[model samples]
Structures are given as structure tokens and as C-alpha cells.
Target: MTVTVRDLRPEVPADVERFARSRHLAIPYVLWTPEAIVHRTTRTHPDAHYRSLVAEEDGETIGTAQVGIAHDSGEPGQGYLNIYVQPDRTRRGAGDLLVRAAEEHLTALGATKLFSWVLDEPGNRAFAERHGYRASRSAHFLRLDLANGALPPLQDLPPGVELRRAADFADDPRPMFELDAETTSDEPSDVGADLTDYEAWIEESWKHPLLDLDLTSVAVVDGRPVAFSAAYTDRATRYSTAMTGTARAHRGRGLAKLAKNDSLHRARAAGYKEAFTGNDADNEPMLAINRWFGYEICATEVRHVRELG
Candidate 1:
């Protein structure tokens, strides 16, 4: 069986579906859809040089990779390549070929450092190590049974603060953009992003195919968004928190938890059954809040890095 790696044909519906399916089968915790994949491939900033690749065996796509330069990062020459192979299609040359293609693409674009997330399992880690990547920080994929789990009761709005849905910012989303930029800059990650482009955020995040504006909860103080929990849904039974954060000035007030709780309640009310979220292992505050909402760590992935010549 000859396995070949090639660029995903975004124009081909079947190819896009297969790529999304491969990702879902390999990493069930994260949300992936054909629309989301296409958005990431086409809507990402040109500076990112994003490319989605698929590994095919005989006429079936069995693996996928998202390769890109970290354009928004303050540091240059940092690139990322995340690969996933369908569970039933492993041990083939798909993974290695995908890696080779991804690395070559990024390296040709002047990437001096490459980062990848590998499942915490021994085999996955060994595979990354075999390709000269070393494990660094780790993150956890947390899941909550929104249908069966007991969510915290919605608390009365604190004085001077009001709860609002992300849709409320439809007429003017600059405030939401400001809040997102602030919170995103503080997120713990191997590559730091500077969200200074409002237009880019609108296209790449606010208008994302999976973003569920009606279910996204935000805390507003004096008409300004201070905290928020961004929601993403598969438009089915699955929901996820894309991001939950409090503005720097509002960190000590538990506002992030409040927003997230409100968002979760809204998601459950809207018929979402399962909710998934991910957090850096060192982000104790967010972890504590998720635990309070009955989320359990279902899986962990370690970030690995390799310096390219």
C-alpha cells in the first residue's frame, strides 16, 4: 500500500470531509469540521502561510496536518505542524510522509523553529522524538457532560456588571475584539500571539463557522466587555469553549468563571450534550474554574519543539 501526502483540495467536498473525519477519529476531544478546516486554510492571515495537507492511501485519506508560520507571534521563524492519523490507519508511512511534507513547507518559508503537539501516549511521544522534537509544556483536554453534569447555578449579576450574549456586539464588535486581544495575549503557549489586527480577528475568529454567538457569554461593565467565554458548537450535540478569559484589570473577581458558567448554561439549554475545552497545564486558575464546573481531564498532549537548520 503506497501512502502519499499532498495538499488538501479545498474545492473538493469529499476531500475536505475526509480530512475532517480523519482528525475527528484521531482526536475526538477537539472540534473539527469541513467548514472549519476550509476557513482555517483560506481565512488565516497571508503572513501565516497556512496549508492543510492530507495523507492518502490508495484512494482514502487517512491522515491530516495543519502547517503554518506563527505570523501573529512577536517572535519570528516560529512555525507549527499538527498531524493526526486515523486510529485504524496507523503504522503506515502516512505519518512520516506528512511530517516530511509539513516540515519542508515550513522550512522553505524560513522557519527556524518548529512546534507540534503530540499525544501524551508513549508511541506518539516516541514518534515526535524520532523526528528530533523534544517534549516541552503539556495541556489537557477537559470534557463535561453538559446534559448530565450539574452546572453551577447562574448567580445574580454583580452590581455594576451585566451579562450579555456575544451577539449583542453584532452592530459593533470592537469591544469584543479588544477583550479578546487582551486575554489572548496573556494566554500561556509555546508561541505568543499579538492580536493587533482587528479585521483579521473578525474574519479568523468572530466570523468563524463554529463560533456560536448566541451561546457565548460576556460580562459587561459600564457597557464595556470585561470578561467572556467564547462558545463553539458543531451545530449538533457537541459544544466547546473556544476561549474563556477575564481582562487584566478584572482578573481577581471571578468574572471569567461567571461568564463561562453562563455560557455553559446557555449551551445546555440549547441542547448541546457534551462540552469540551483545553487548557495549558500550568494555567491553574482556569483549571480550577473548569473543575468547579465538573469538567474532567480526558486526555493530555505535550508540546514538542525542534530547531531547524
Candidate 2:
């Protein structure tokens, strides 16, 4: 039972399928697909040097690692590698082998600080600690039943606001992108990213395989996207919220709630049966909003950080 780590062969369909399956099984909160796996590898910036590696035992893939530098980050030396080992194959050396390879790759790319997300379980925490990674802020993965769960009824926008779909910005998504940039710049995260590159944002975000523009709801205030909830779907029954935030000027108006609720209602009507989203534990407002939509805490993943010289 020799465990080895190797770069995923994007050209091979089965390899990507296996990798996505393992990831989905290990962390069902986020959406993952073979197309998504391949799109990321093909479209990521070269500076990031992103790669998806699968840990294999004999002929089966038991663990996955998505390693990359935060090339767009204003601050340098930030890199990330999220490792997910199939729950059924945890005791094996797949995880350790995958992390070892990931560390080596990031080091070669001049990464000085590394980040990872581990399930908030004792064993998972121990594994991260044993590897010299220190605990950091945690987040909750929330789930909602779209098929049978009742969603908040869609309401008319307040006096000056209007509801719109992301598809409405097809001709000029720059505004939405700008809004995303503004909100994301302030988002609580271990690695900060700069979304100044329009072309890159189109290739990596707007055109992402899972991004569902029709289901993404945004609140337009005096013709500008003031708040939005980005939705990603597998083009099937599962949907996820990529982000739900509002511009600083629009924070106290419940616009975030309105946008998210609109998006959820649209998603349910579009035949999506399951929905997932995540929020930092301290984000009480967003947490309360999700709860209002009948979402339950499905799981939690704690961000872990490590300093490497």
C-alpha cells in the first residue's frame, strides 16, 4: 500500500472525476466538479503556479490538494494548499504525503507563509498542529434544503433599490466586478487578493464553470450594484453561495438579506435541491440572515496557518 502524490492529469477525465468525488465526499459544503477542477488549473495566473495533486494508493485516489500562491494578493509570501483526504481512508499516509509535496511546491515558489483549512475536529486539529500550523479564525458551513424547505418570500425592493440578476450585466460586468472587488477587499480572510485584472476576473470568476449568473441576485441602488449574493450551481440540483455582501454605503439597509433571499428563491425555483454557504464565525449579521432563510449549521472548517522559512 504505497501512497504517492502526483499532479492531477487534467487531460484525463477520470482523474478529475475521482478528485472531485473525493473532495465532495470529504467536504460537501462547497461545490466541486471535474470541469471546475480543470478550469482552475487551466485559467489560474502563472504567477500563482497552481496545481491540483491527488494522493493515490495503488490505483485509487484517496486525498486531494489544491496548492497555489496568492499571486494577486497585494501582500506577498501568501500561499494556500487545502488538503482533503477521503474520510474512509484517513489513517493512511495519503494526507502527510500530500502535505509534504504541497509544502515542497510552495517553498520552491518562494512562499513564506502558508494557509490551510481543516475540519474543526480534534483529529484534524491535531494533524494540523503536528505539522506546525497554528489555529486561526474559524468558519461555519451552512446548508439549506431547497427542494422542500420554505424560503423567505421575495419582497419588493425598498424605495430606491431594485433587484437584478447577474445576467443583466452581461454587456458590462465591470460594475459587478468592481463591487465584488470592493466587498472582497474588506472580507475577512487569511490571504488578501487583488481583483484589479478585468480579464483575469472574467476568466477565473465570471466565466467559472459553476457560476450561475441567472441565479445570482444583486441589489441595484440608483443604477449601481450595491449588494449581491453570488450563486454557483453544478447545473443540476446543488447550489452554493459564493458570496453575500454589501457595499459600505449600503450596509444598514438589509440589502444583503434581500439579495441573498432573492437569490435563494430563484435557485429553488430553478430546480436546485440543495444549497450551501459559509461565513466566518464572528459574522453575526450574515449568520442571522442565513438562519432566517432556514439554513442550518452543517459543518465547520477552521483556518490554519503556518510560517515557513
Candidate 3:
């Protein structure tokens, strides 16, 4: 069987579906849909040079790669290429072809350092090493059975605080944006980000296909959002917490936990059977919070980096 790699054809529904399917198969912990794939292709910042690559064997698409530059990053020459091959279709050279294609594409765009996420399995780790990538910090993908598992009982709102859905910010989401910016800036990462471009955040994040505003819970204090749990749903039975964070001033109040618990209870009540979230391995506070809500580690992935000459 001849396996070849090619750019995903976003205009074609089947290609987008196939790409999402490959990703869903390779990494079930994360949510992936045709609409999300299309959004990434068409709505991402132009400087990111984002391209989704698919590896096809004969007539079947069996693997996918998301390659892009860190366009918004203040540090230049940073790029990322995450590749996922179908479990049932591996050992067919699809992965190698996709990696080569991804590297070539990113290199052509002037990438000096490239990063990728590899599942923390022996074979996957070996694959990265063979490709010249060195393992970095790892993360865990946690899952909670929203339908069958017990969630923390919601507590009475603190005297000065109120809980609200992200949908309530329809009139002006700038406050939510500011909160997101601050929380994200403090998140642990190999490449830190600054979420300053409001217009770009509106297009790339606020308008994202999976962002479920009604399910996202936020804590407000005197009409200002102080903490939040951003939600993403697949319009099916799955839900994920894209982020849960408290503003700097609200850090010691346990507001982040409160926001996430409210969001989780709301999600379970809304019939989302499965819930997924991720956290950096060293983020002890968030990890402890997720554990308090009974989330169990389902998988781990190590960030791998390669420096280009």
C-alpha cells in the first residue's frame, strides 16, 4: 500500500471529517470535530501558517498532523507540529511521511525550534527520539464520568460573589477576555503567551466551534468576572474544561474550584456523560482540584522539542 501525505482539503467535508476522525482515534482524550478542523484551517492567524496534513494509504486517510508557527508569540522561530496516527493503521509508514511533511513545511516557514506532543508510551517515546526530538515536561489527560460519577456538591455563593455563565457576557466580553489573558499568562508552559489581541481572540477563541458559552461558568464580584471555567462541548455527549483559573486577586479564595464545580454540575445536569481535561504535571494545585472532583488520569503525553540547524 502506497502511503502519501497531503494537505487537508478544508473545502471538502469528507477530508475534514477524515482528519478529525484520525485525531479522535489517535487521541480520544481531546475533542475533535469537522467544524473545529475547518475553523482551525480558515480562522487561525495568518502568521501561524497553520496547515493540517493527512496521510493516506491508497484511498484511506489514516493519520493527521497539525503544523503551525507561534504567530502570536513574542518569541519568533517557534513552531509546533503534533502528529497522530490511527491506532489500527500504524506501522504502515504513515507517521514518518506525515512527520517529514510537517517538518519540511515548518522549516520552510523559518522555524528554528519545533515542538510536538507524544503520548507517553514506550513506542511513542521511541518514535520521538528517533526523529531527533527530546522529551520535555509531561502532562496528564484526566477523565471524569459526569453521568455516573459523583461531583462535588455546589456550595452557597460567597456573600460578595455570584456565579454566572459565560453567555452572560454577550454584551461585552472584554472583561472575560482580560481574565482569560491573565489566567493564561500564569499557566505553566514551555512557551508562554500573551493574549493581547482582542480582535484576534474574538475570531480565534470566542468564535471557536467547540466553545460552549452556556456551559462555561464564571465567578463575578460586583459585576466584574474574577474567576472562570471555560467549557467546550462536541454537541454530543462529551464535555471538556478548556481552562479553569482565578484572577490574581481572587487566587486564595478557592474561587477557581468553585467555578469549575459549578460548571461540572451544570454539565452533568445537561446530559454530557463524559468529561475530559488536561493539566501540566507540575501544576499541583489544579491537579489536586481535579482529583477533588474525582477525575482520574487516563493518559499522559510528553512535550518533545527539536532544535533545527
Candidate 4:
């Protein structure tokens, strides 16, 4: 059987489901649904040049790749291609075909620098290095057994603080947007991003298919949102914390922890059995918070970069 790489057919339900299924088999830690897949290819900003690719072998999709330029970065020519192949489908040229197709696409888009996330296993790292990629920073994927493991007891808010659900701000989500922008600017990432486009944020984040506003928790102080934990659920048993952050002025007060704990507790009560989150290796505070909540590191992935000619 021969493996071929091609763009995903977003309009086909079976094709979209196969793409999502391939992702689930490759990386079960995060949520992947057909709606989320379509939303990504159809709703992302035009400048990003995002395209989802699939590796087909004998009429079956065995791998998937998300290829695009980092248009939000201040630096031009930065591109990313994250590929995941079904665990049972390796050693069949599917991964190689997907990578080659993704690189060709990004290079055609004038990307001078290419980035990809490689699982930290020896074989995966070897594959990336053999393709001229060098390992850089690393990140850990943490998992919490919300259905069985013990979670930190929820704490009461301080005298001037109160816990609120993100749904409470549905009538006007601009405040949440402002808080997200401020906190996201401080996140540690290789490509610095400026979330200045309010309308884009609403379309990309606020209206995302997986965002669960009812389960999201926010810490409000004097009617102002100071800390928040955004929740994304697959409407099944898996829940992931998309983002958790506290404002600069509210740092060192443990408000972010409070928000996350509340959010996690609510998720558990709502029948979410598994929780997943990611943290940069250099991010100590957030890592500590996850550790405090009984989240254990399940996997690690290293960022690899290749300079394109």
C-alpha cells in the first residue's frame, strides 16, 4: 500500500471525523472534535494561511498535519507544522509523506523558519533530527483524574474577592476579552503574539466550539475580573484548561489557583472524568499550581526548529 498526503476535505463529515479520529489516536490528552476541526480551517484569520493535511494509506487516513504560518507573530516567515500519526500506523511512510508535504507548503508560503512539536521519545526526536530539525524548548502535558483523584479543596474568596462563572459575562464579554489579552501577553512562548484584535478574539476564542463558559471560573474584585481559568470541554468526559492567568496587579495572591480549583470542581461535578493541561518547562508558578491539584506529567514534547533556504 502507498501513502499519499493531501489537504483535508472539511465539508465531508466522514473525512472530518477521520481526521479527528486520527488525532485522538495520536494524542488522546487533548480534545479533538469534528466541529473544532472545521472551525479551525474555516474560521481562522486569512493571513495565517492555515491548512490541515491528511496522510492516506489504502483509502484510510493514518496521519494528520496542521500547517500554517504564524501570522500573528511580529516576525515574518515563521511557520509551524504539527503532525500526528496513528500509533498503529507507524513505519509505513505516512509520517514522512505528511512532513514533506507540510514543509513544501510552508516553504511555498515564504516561511524562512519552520517549527514543529516532536514527542520527546527517542524515535520521535530522531525522526525530527534526521529531517534537519534541532530541538529547542520543551513542554509537559499533565493529566488529572477528575473522576477519581483527590483535588485541592475549594477555598473561599478573600474579603474583597468573589468567584464568578464566565457565563455571567455573556451579555458583555469585552471584560473577559480584556483580561484574556492582558494575561495572554504575559505567556511564555517562542513567537510573541499581540491579541489586539477584539473582533478576532471573539471569533477565534470566545465563540470556539469547545469553550465551556458555564464551567469556566473567574475571580472578580470590586466588579473587575482579576483572575480567570478558561475551560474547554468536548461534551464528553474530557476537559482541558485552555488558559489560566492572573492580572499583573493581582499576582502573588493565589487568585489564579482559586479560579482553577473552582473550575475543576465544577467540571468534575458535571461528569468530566479527565482533565488535561500543558505548561512550558520554564513556567514554574503555573506548573506548581498544576502539581498542587494532583496533575501528573503524562507526556513531554520538544519544540524543533529548522531554517528553510
Give the TM-score of each candidate: 0.99, 0.98, 0.98, 0.98
TM-score of 3: 0.98
Error (Å) of candidate 2 at residue 77 is: 0.5
What would the per-residue lDDT of candidate 2 be over residues 178-251, giving only the tens digit for each residue? 99999999898878877899988999999998999999999998899999999999999999999888999889
Error of 4 at 171 (Å): 1.7
**Candidate number of the best lDDT:** 1
List of clashing residue pairs for candidate 2: none
Task: For candidate 4, write residues 1-309 as lDDT tens digits.
Answer: 989999999999999999999999998888999999999989888888999999999889999999999887878999999999898999899888889999888999899999999889998899899999999999999999999989989887888999999999998999999999889888888776778888988999999999999999999999999999999999999999999999999999999999999999999999999999999988987898899999999999999999987
The ten-residue window of minimal lDDT in model 1 covers 249-258
- Compared with the true structure, model 2 gives a TM-score of 0.98
* Cα lDDT, all candidates: 0.94, 0.92, 0.93, 0.93
lDDT (Cα) of model 4:
0.93
**Comparing candidate 1 with candidate 2, which one achieves the higher TM-score?**
1
| lDDT tens digits by residue: candidate 3, 143-204 | 99999999989988889999999999988999999999999998898877889999989999
Instruction: Flag regions of model 4 displaced more than 4 Å.
Output: none
Off by over 4 Å in 1: none
lDDT score of residue 10 within candidate 2: 96
lDDT of 3: 0.93
lDDT for 138 (candidate 1): 99
